[model samples]
Target chain A: MLNAIFSGDTPRSRPLTAILLVILVCLALGPFLFDGTRAFSTLGMICVFIVVVASYDLMLGYTHIVSFAHTMFFGIGAYGMAIATDAMGNNFTAILVGLAGAIALSVVLSLLLGLLSLRVKAIFFALVTLAVAFAFLSLATQLYNITGGEDGLRVRVPRELGPAFRPFDGELRGFSIVTFLSGLFTEPGNLGEVLRESVFKVRFSGRELMYYVAFVVSLLVFLFLLRMVNSPFGRVLQAIRENEFRAQALGYRTVFYRTAAVIVSAVLATLAGVMFALINRYVNPENTLDFQLMVFILLMCVIGGMGTLYGSVVGVALFLLAQNYLQDLLRLFAAQVPEGGVMAELVAPDRWLLWFGVLFVLSVYFFPTGIVGQLRIWSQRRKPAA
Target chain B: MSALEKTLDNKSARRERPWKALGKGPRARFAAFREEKPHLFLLALMMLVPLFMINPTTWAVLTISGLAMGAMVFLMASGMTLTFGLMNVLNLAHGAFISLGAFAGATVLTVWLNGYSGDSSLLVNLVAILPALGFALAVAGLVGLLFERLVIKPVYGDHLKQILVTVGGSIILLELIQVIWGPNEIPVPRPDALRGAFIVSDAIPLIGGIALEKYRLIAVLLGLAVYGLMTWVIDRTRVGVLIRAGVEDREMVEVHGYRIRLLFLGVFVAGSALAGLGGAMWAMYREIITAHMGDELMISVIVVIILGGLGSIKGCFYGAILVGLINLYVGFLEPRLAAVATVGLMVGVLMWRPQGLIPVIKV
Candidate 1:
């Protein structure tokens, strides 16, 4: 069935198939090779980010709307779930309710925004959305009673069917259960016991479990988006992007289509938010609604190549990896510096923002197509000669 | 073609009677009456309305501060609108230029006026005003030139690239500021001359016996002076004519043997310098300057521009005043909701007229 899906005579198909195969193989072996509870947790985080970035690209790249408020939707979903699960004290039901509420709110917001500024072109649209996001952030922070102000709201974990999984300790039984359900198996007895104890002892916190759950949800959402992107509706969206007026002239309801795209993207963002809330077991107004977070998501979409699904995934992987590990790597390098030296000043924590700014400028200027786009271009160029 | 010709004819007519009439239609006439010559009739009524109200200070502060702020915004927004209209550039980093001025002024006080403690000595005053204005204008102008040549020039007519480059430029400027000046907030002290409020009355029985701050009254006067000066420069000067022509058609102006590039450079420098001046004055008024002030103030400035309609000076003044009133009104309702109030105003205005309160004529 998958081969048939790629049966088109286009030259791009074979390379993409090969790439997919490699990814599948890696995914299959990832849990075992990486081992340890921390590694798995990291994988989950990457997956969640991938979903968020992918959705961001769907609106930005496909619709050609450089929305600065995408993170607001994510916040809505997260806060929704947080409010429901923690304040309302409903778990399973809350998840569904939160998802629905987020989607509904996103649709309304998108519709209103579309009605207001859909006629405005390009940068003005971006500015309007930026204003909206700022306004939303201020509103969120101002409503301290509800959003817990800057400190944010803390959430309690939902009860699991069995005793809650422990990490880096003798939570071997629980770890085994999770691994088994996730389609992985381990040797029984002392080795399993040792692994389980290590995992539980290492703090198999609520964050790690949320990571797994987030990964599963993200995978499902990604596949659904992938399928949608291949559909006729997605083609219309692409058409709108290429030439909006031309699309409108063709008797298409351009605003409706664009608004629909925004809403769909918002729903996906909200899903990521919910998962983020689940993982962190906390949701704050600042965490989800800040301009910095919005800019970061935008950076991912821009760096990944705004319109492509694969690009978003690649962008997410690169961004999350750099963000999480780069500091540590820099720290290690800093440690080698002679004490009280200029080198120490260069690697100081405050100076990290300088590096990020430089990287942002470089990436926007030089790597506009990002990693996946560049790779695809390279492959295409190489193919003609081949 | 007729519409174009009609617009041209209307432009000529406007030039003949530049200050003759406020606007056409009864609604507009009423609005102009309310705004331009309200004659303290409403001020008296406002005084009476606030009578017997607890915390009358809040009302007095909100009213006077809102008016002062409105005037300040009018000046800043006028420059911003003209630049945007003529240049077609959003100028995302405009706020940075403003902060540069504020920092320059504050630094001058710290370094030069550290020990001087006199009331309106001409020398001390010159020390404060000259260094602040000169440094602000020079640095801001140079930065403006650099920005236009190196950054904005390439991105002309390309909105996305402009946004990206400008936003990146903003971040770079922000970091540079942080590097030069530490992250702590710096205070800008008011000169002894402008320190105290005017005593309207020792005892008044209006608005339930409210007393307004004197500094705010002085700020209002200064704001009016600045506004008058800007209006005079824009409307009565030869440079103003060239600017008006350039805004209408840069190509036409170039074809007429004028150097459009020099005009643009001059305009950019002037805009930046004006922003700096506003920032400097605002710093003294607010008494604090921080790295993040640019970002905070930029939101409202952008809102003012959007509401007034980009590129229209008259629009900017009206929009600023309207937003200022809304902000004060909302601040009175709930201080925390002040930001939201501005946004709500923007959203409402956008819904009613997405082109803004004053639509710029597109060439």
Candidate 2:
């Protein structure tokens, strides 16, 4: 069942499998297992980013194409939803219209860009996409009347998906089976007391439903990417990446395959954007279209492992964990150091990106293959040769 | 040979005698050039945006400003293109050197030189400006050396890792810059001698005023000097030959007992120095320097380099000027056209020549 769900492309290494399980369980039980709006928001972002980073991996990892316009497609999906919903009221039909329109736009743009530059060198493609993305960003920023400029467009989901609407009249207290099972066997002071204060509360509100929406949609997309990657078409992509000249010699139309990869990746990235706009209820040049986000996505893909669909999952969870918590940890460290000193400045919570930058460089230098790839190597080494 | 064939050849040559005489003049030479170099023909076509439509004064101002902008852009793009040609290292952290140079120049101009920049005496103004430019070059070049060691060296020949590591390096440098310069936009006021414009043609018929800015003229001169120096080095120097040889075949150059590695290092540093020089000029041009200034300029540089043709300096130069002019002309012609002018130019060029305006010729 697990193998089928993972599309027969399991996380081969035992530890990788374990981490994937932990991520899946936590993300699946996010509403019931996490507290505060901050935690839920992080969880929701991780889900959306899983799809986003996976789509990037499809191109960068599978096809070895380094494109920088992934975020532009993301922004398109977001702005599409924002403009349509803003003008036509926040309804389900408007949201669907936005998704369809955004996908259509992404298909055309990505197709044109791919056919034009995919024939060039990788560095050329990367640079051209960067220029295009920068133009798109400025375009989004300049059209303030529609995109709200720097203030961003506020995304309002349909009534059923909105936070104000509840599915039930009353809230349901969350329960953790791990604690209940341990309490039952250990002769706890009160048998049911362990269930009452489970450290997390669950409510049958539209907010929790929104989390589920993001979670379910992301899972479905992730599985689809995995299935696609393991298929014969995906094998051809890998063959081309490994040696494009040889692949061409073997009769594959290399440019056509590359263009198809770009389009599929872009469409998926747009869907991720649709998920983000729905979950966050916001779209802006800063949030949806920043080059910084492009770098971060690349970091996550590399750290987790490129060419592995599950790598994005591991990467998104790991990187976001660092992003969300590393700053607070630094704040505590800054307190330990003297004020106005070099150490304090370096340890400033705002400078967490500096640390991540260091880590990214070190990871590139040391592993180059990423965490999952490294684990697989270790496991293969330990296995006896035939 | 048959007597009829000889007579036919003689008749054909006699028929073209007047046109051959016409071809001996500069106009025919130009026509020959247009036939030989189609990219230049298109470039000329782009530049021939009508002057009769707009006031000649606005046209002059716009053209001069466009040339100045193109020169600064040429400085940055040539460095990038040369480095790529030499070693295949496309350092995304190139903007870091630019930002670092801007900050360094700004520091000298604003903080170190103090009030001397406001002096009317050109020599006194030079005292402040020269040091700023020199210091920017020195600091950014040295930092680029360290960055190459730390970030670029480990990931040679790997474009993917190069992008990631250089970006990481860029992040670290930008943060360090913020740490030193304090995350605020610092103002770099120009020297008093270079503050205003020079009205060169106020009395010309139909053209009321041809006021050219003192600073933009200086920029044009600097760009020309840089281009001349590069052409001299690449054409007339032994090191230039070695660089060209290295680009064609690294192993063969190494086989000749020359340390191609040293050549690579020298080229990277020189490229960084050029970027630093451009950054210093850019700081003064805008009069305000921010940490993200280089990042912002990088987009334009990318567009310039793409249109110029990757790894080709001459192509980059042409691309820069074309983009610069298009920016000004379109902005003045139609505001909406101005919005997509650069992109439109790039797309049009790509459609015509995907390799770029000037495809690299093996020298």
Candidate 3:
């Protein structure tokens, strides 16, 4: 059924297919490539965000709905999982139950918001959703008994999923690839052990396990959304987006389609939230249900190119990569500057937000179509010229 | 005659009998009267809550404080409504202007308070307060002009782009403010003369023991004065006519050989100045100014605008008051659910009247 939905997209989506496949392969083997806690964790986060932002694109890009409540749904999923794990043990059943509960809540909430969408105009709809999301954030903070207030809720993973494995050890075992990799950088004898006891002491641990989990979930979500967007249903949504009145006049019940789109998008975002909770082993209002998170997702979609699933993928990947690396790059730059120098402030990690904000504004104005859209345009132009 | 000359002529002519010149005054007043009857009833309903829930004196205090809070919010929200109505720009960065104003006021007060001899005279305090307000308003207005040109001008009609770009602009502005003023909250105290409350019990018999803050009473008066000024300029003047006409049809106004954009820029600057003034007042009200104060309060401002029909100043005032009342009532009733109550009120209001309490019928 999924194949049938996506069959028509094959010819035109060759490049996207290639890009997504490459990402999947990289994510699958990400632990081996980077082989550390930071690498696996960052990769896991990027995977979850890929699903999160792509799901947002379903509403914003394809359906032409600008709902700010997506992050609220995301938070609900994380908090639901966190609460469930707190109530029940960190078993598979609890995770499943939590996910089901979160999806159900999101569906109900999105449907209510959809009804609101039916009542208000586009701008008004955005405000209403923003208001609702803010209320939810406030509730999360205030409901200390359930949500843990500002301190947030932490969960213990199941023993198997927990950080039990050590990738780099002091043992001289030459059989493992981790040992072999560590051998390449360090000296021949006790130097390797010393390095292993010191800098190389960093372990991939359960992060690799979490990475695979996030990877698998992200892959499933991306595939499902891809199929959904290429289906006849997605075409109807696109039609509604392009011209809602005309689509309504042409016998498409726009309200139903729009509501359906929001429902699907909200569910997908909830899934991403659940996966993110697993990776972080925690849930907080700031991390999940923030207006800033919604803006971040919007930035990803726009910077990637809205109306394209692959664009969202590229966007999430690029943005998370920049967010993770840019601070490091700035810190590196900061080290070169003399202490007490005024220029040192220029490269501080805290100043990255200022620069990123400038980049975001400039991108919106200059590259409104985003990276993927721009690439597609260039390609089209080249073909015509040829 | 040139359009400016005609407008001047029209202004002088209307000045002769300002009250009678706008023939719709009485009918508009009647419409407003009919519209506000529900709100008055709502206010009465709120008043009955104090009798049921708490003591009369505490209720009186809460009511006074809430109204004061509403007045400050109205001052902040009015500029937003004007810009949205005239420019078709959803300026998410309006909060930045508010913050800048607060910061400017704080900077002035910090300097003035440091030199003060701790005198309790109202005149001495006013000398310090006037310059602070002027500095804040001027700074905010100038910044608003730059923001319009650099950030807002590029994305005129598109709401999505407008929201994103303005949000980005606001973030940059917020960061810049933090860089300048440091991230810590700057304390902003009220003037010595305006610090305490007046015991209503001594003045009035039935309302005895009801203490209202001297500053709050002043805030209410200030809010009313601003509202009065806005109405006069918007409804009773030739510029008001031109603005209304421009809102109705920008091209038509432009065809009259007038630079509507310049007029709009003036409105934007004025709006920013109002936001700054509100920020300064709010800083005094809160007794501290954070970089995020304006952004934090912006949510309330947006809620007010939406509650009062969008782009309608009168509507925004009513909405602000309603929000302030709901906030106080809920805070007193259930502290945990206080935030939820205002949003709930908004949802309920929107559900009842989708266009808000007073839908401005766009001409």
Candidate 4:
């Protein structure tokens, strides 16, 4: 059914096929090829962030409505899951119940916002969403009894998923024998021990498990969104984005479509939020719902290139990577400077925000299309020149 | 002789009449007042209701602060509205100009206090005020001019690009301030003369009590003075007429040989300088200046502009006061709930009146 839906237009099929092949290769090699728990953890983090960026892109890029409250949905999902699994003490029903609650809450909130926001265009919409996000943050903070306020909520991993397994352990040995996966590894060595440790660590830890779950869920969401974007509904949304009045004139209910897009995007964001909760084994109002998070999400979408799923994924990867590395890079630069030098101040990790601000400004000024868009342009230029 | 000149003269005459025609009889005034009475009554109610509900100290402080801030919004937003109405450029860096002005004011104050052992006299402090205001305005004007020429001119009507550039500019300005001033919050002391509260009631009968802060009362008075002056300039003066015409039809004005770009620059500078003045005053009110103050204050100003109806000066004043009251009321009710209340009010107002309370006549 998936193949049938996507099996038209050679131009589109080629890229889609290549992408699928790459994904398959990555999934197949993810466990076997990687060594050290850090490698797997990094990949897991990237995958989860990709989910977040994808949902953000769906609303802002494709729909042309900048919902600044995107992070609030993530917060709701995270808090919902945390409250369910930990406070409610219903592990079996937790994920399901939490997700359902999150979706319902988000849908209702978005509906209210949609009615308020759908009439306005551009900056007004941005401001309204910003206000809504701030409101959510305030509520989350004020309702400290439930949300845990600034401190946040933490959950313990279920014993079944806890990190007790070794490769040679009876339970895993039996599973390996049954699956004929024994040949995948030789006698236990450092590499084997490392792999074993990683697997055990991941299984025992709720966060690691959450990461994997989030990755799978995000993959499914990305696929679902891909389908939506290619569908007639998606086309109508794009039309609404390009020209709302014309779409309305053509008898397409633009508001309804836009609202539906917002709700769908909200659900995707909630999924990411849920996974985020699981990964951290905690949920905090401040971390999840704030101006900083909103700005970062906007920066990700804007810097990545809006209206493109791949752009969002790439954008998040670039942003997180830059963020993670920029501090180290700045420290390295700072170290070379003489002791008590002014340059040292510039290189401090605290000063990273300033640099990020500078980069944001420069990027917006010159590369409004973002890193992915720029790369695409460069590749096109290279092809033509060749 | 020119169409622009003729229009300007007509606008000037109309603006001058509001004050001059104040002597009209109660019956004739009552009839005219009936026409514009609702908005005026709403404004009065907005100002009065908070006083009745909250502690007198809080009410006095909030009212004075709101009016002061409203005046700043009026000044900053008037330019922004005109720029948007005329050129359709959303200058996100407008907040940065406010910050720049604030820093300028702080620098001036710092310089003035350089070698003084004891507290300065009221006369000395009063004398220093002129230079501080001048320094702030000059720096802000220069920054506005440079911003327009360097950054804003290229992306005149392209909103997305404009947004990107201006947002980027704001970030840069924020960082620049951080770099220059360091991360620590700086103290912005009120001049000696402006200190303490004026006892309005030693022991009044009906009303519980009210003792207004001398500084805040002064700030409000200053705000009113500026507001009145701006209204006169915008509505009655020759320059005001050109601005109105320019706002209404920039292309036609340009075609008629008026230097629209120069007019834009003038308005931008004036707007920015006013924002600077507001920032300086805000520093005194908050009693501390930090790197993030501009962004914090900008949020309230943005809410005001959105609520008031963008591109309308009258709307900005009305919107600012409404927002100011909402802010104070919410703060009074629950301090943490202020953010929620402000946003909720804005969202509700936007929903009820999509174009804002007083919709701008789009160019």
Who wins the DockQ comparison? Answer: 3
**Clash pairs for candidate 2:** none
lDDT of 4 by residue, B29-65 (tens): 7645543443365467677777777866667667766
lDDT of 2: 0.84
User: Lowest-lDDT window of 10 residues in candidate 4 chain A?
Assistant: A171-180
What's model 2's lDDT at B105? 90
lDDT of 4 at B344: 74
Best by lDDT: 2
Q: Is candidate 2 or candidate 3 better by DockQ?
A: 3
Model 1: residues >4 Å from true position, as ranges?
A: A3-44, A119-122, A161-163, A166-207, A329-347, B1-60, B74-79, B116-126, B187-193, B202-222
Candidate 4, number of clashes: 4
- DockQ for each candidate? 0.39, 0.47, 0.47, 0.42
Model 4 DockQ vs. reference: 0.42
Q: Tens digit of lDDT per residue, candidate 2, span A52-170?
A: 99999999999999999999999999889888899889898999999999999999999999987855666688887888888788878877887898899999888888878889887
The per-prediction CA RMSD against the true structure, in angstroms, equals 6.6, 5.2, 7.4, 7.3
Model 2: chain B TM-score relative to the native chain B? 0.87
Tens-place lDDT per residue, model 3, A200-292, is 223456656677778888877877887888788999999988888999999999999999998988998898888888889988888998777
**What's the distance in Å from true for residue B41, model 1?**
17
lDDT value for model 1 = 0.70
- Candidate 3 lDDT over residue span B120-193, tens digit each: 78888887788888988999999999988998988988887888899899888888887777778998767787
Model 1: fnat (fraction of native contacts): 0.42
Best-matching candidate per TM-score: 2
- Candidate 3: count the clashes: 2
Which whole-number lDDT from 0 to 100 does residue B242 have in model 1? 79
Best-to-worst order by DockQ is 3, 2, 4, 1
User: What docking class should model 2 receive?
Assistant: acceptable
Query: Ten consecutive residues with minimal summed lDDT in candidate 3 chain A?
Result: A170-179
